[model samples]
Target: MPRSLRARKLENAVGLAVIVALAIASVLPLIHILYMVIVRGVEAIARIGLYRFLTEPPHPFDPQNPGGIGPALVGSLELSGLAIAVATLIALPASVLIAEFRGSRISRGTLLLALTLVEFPTILVGLTVYAVLVDHVVGGYNMLAGAVALTLVILPYMAVQASEALRGVPEGVREAAYSLGATRLKTVYALIAPAARRGILVGILIGLARAAGETAPLLFTVGGAYEGYHLCLYKVGGAVPLMIYQFIQMPYKPAQDLAWGAALVLMTIIVGVMLLARLLVKEVKIL
Candidate 1:
């Protein structure tokens, strides 16, 4: 080979090697975390029995009794459900308005604010909600406060996704609706919104998945009730992430085990939701 050709080939090979190394380096930590959680969490669940582990609360100070994460699991579901409902209710209308009035100052301002908030620190949202709801209004931490905090954390994401989904509807569809004498509100609600339902549902699932795994937002708002299961919005509650955060720091074997199990469950939930969203996206593309 010519000398310059040889040098170019060597440089390309070196660049490829570097990219491979970076990719592996980034994926290694996630692999390690998944391995540890699976191994230890499975052992913990096996020791306690899966049924009991799913239906009981943790005994943090005890080393022999490996308790379940029932309370936290239920609380996570309730909080995610409530937060998603409220966020979707508010986001849908705002998203429609933005899509319909793309040139208006209000629409531009709302879209800009939502995009800006998509990357905001969630812990600050937690602190703000704690001060506003728990300190002044609710008088203490409760499920409602936690749900409100999560709603705030997930709202921007839901709004942005819904807006994009609405905009994805063909302009021809809007024109057709207008030519059919449909009112502006009717065209948006009856035609554009239904056409974009799948995308909106994907956003809701993604936001709910994000909310379900949030620990910092629930740290000061949910009150961490592990003694029993709670279903009321006005009551204190526990979440899988919150339990893992509290348990992993304790100086007990059982608590640590419980934390691993909780982490596994939470990871499964978040991953499942994301995969469902991916499937929906694929379906959309194939259509």
Candidate 2:
């Protein structure tokens, strides 16, 4: 082989090695964190009984007086659910409009506004929600306020992603739909939306995952309480991330163990959503 060709081959091999090394370095921290959580959490889960641990409130892990995390789980679900619902309602239509009219001044303005919103610090959003809802409106910290704040934080990201997904639908398909005498609205709703359904779903799932793990925004809005399960949207409730934060501050080993378990569960949920989104995208491509 020519010396130049051999040199190029050597360079390619070195580049490949560097890429592999970087990838490993990036992944190792995540793996280490997961391992630590699992190892620590498993003992707590086993001792408390999985069902009891998941269903009860935070209590000192005593065989006689074991308390589970059932209430926190429910509260997390409700808060996250409310946030996701609000974000979806706000994002879907906005995304559709932006995607369909990308070149218009309105679309341009909306895009810029969304970018601005997304870039705003989460603490700022939390403080704003606290001031407006807790001080000005509702008079105290509540789940509704927290949900609203989370929705605001997540909405811009979801909308921007949804718009990008809708734009990914081929122009040819849109033109053909128009040629078939479909109204512009009909073309968008029936044709473009269905075509990009996977992408939209992925965007929503990603938004949900992001919203679920947010701690700073929830801190000011949803004042963390250790009370047992309550469904009142006006009542403050504990969330996994908040609980983890609270637990880590305690000097007790049990609280720390429980924190690890909650962290693991949260991580699992986010990863599950991501995997489902990836599967949906893959399935859509296959079809």
Candidate 3:
């Protein structure tokens, strides 16, 4: 081979080797963590009874006394669901508007502002929301406050992802729709939105996953409670992350084990969401 071609081949080999090594290094920790979580968590789940653990309050799982995490799971689902809904309601339209009107000064400013929001820390977002909604207005920590805080934390990221997805819609498609005499809104809704639906769905799924795993924002806004799982929105609810955090500091072995199980459950949930998102995207592409 010519000298230049030989040098190029060597460089490509080196790059491939580095990429493979880095991929393995990046995945090792996740693999180990998942392995440990599955082992320990499965043991706990089996001992406690998966149905019971999913439908009852956390209690000692000894022969004398058995308890489950039903309430915590319910609360987690409720809070996370609410947060995801609110965030998507705000972010999706904003993203579409921004993407469709990139040249407008207002849209440009709004995009910049959303970008800034993405960099804000979860703790600060929690504190700000708590102060505005809970302390100043509502006068107490509640589900609404927690949801608002989480929405703020997830919205900017979702918006940015959505904007990118919307922008990715082919210009040719838009022009064709316009040539067909479709209004801007109609074209966006009928063509661009459907074409980029997979990306938008993936972004929303990611946002949901982020909201589900958040703890710092929930700390101030959702304040944990051990009892009263069936309370109203104003009532405090215990979450798995907060529960794990609280339990990890205790002197009890059972609490420690429960914390590990909770961690495993949370990871399982986020991973499941991600897998579903991937499957959805794949299916959309296939169709």
Q: How high is each candidate's TM-score?
A: 0.94, 0.89, 0.86
User: How do these models rank on TM-score, best leading?
Assistant: 1, 2, 3
lDDT of 1 by residue, 1-287 (tens): 46798899999999999999999999999999999988988998888898999999878777678789999998998999889999999999988877888999999999999988888889999999999988999798899999999999999888888888999999999999999999999999999999998899998888988899889999999999898988778778889999999989988888888999888888888778888988888642211
Q: Candidate 3, which segments miss by more than 4 Å at Cα?
A: 1-23, 60-66, 282-287
Q: 1-287 in candidate 2: lDDT tens per residue?
A: 45798899999999999999999999999899889888877777787788888888877445455466777788788888999898999899999888888899999999888878877888889999999988888887888888888899889988887888899899999899989999998999898988988888887888888788888888888788866776777877778888889888887777777787788788889889988988887642211
lDDT winner between 2 and 3, please give it.
Answer: 2
Runs in model 2 deviating more than 4 A are: 1-16, 61-66, 282-287
lDDT of each candidate versus the true structure: 0.89, 0.83, 0.81
Residue 267 in model 2: lDDT = 86
Model 3 agreement with the true structure over 96-194: per-residue lDDT tens digits: 988999899978988998889888889998899889978888787777777788889889988887888899888999999999999999999899988
Which candidate's TM-score is highest? 1
Error of 3 at 37 (Å): 1.3
Q: What's the distance in Å from true for residue 153, model 2?
A: 1.6
Top candidate (lDDT): 1
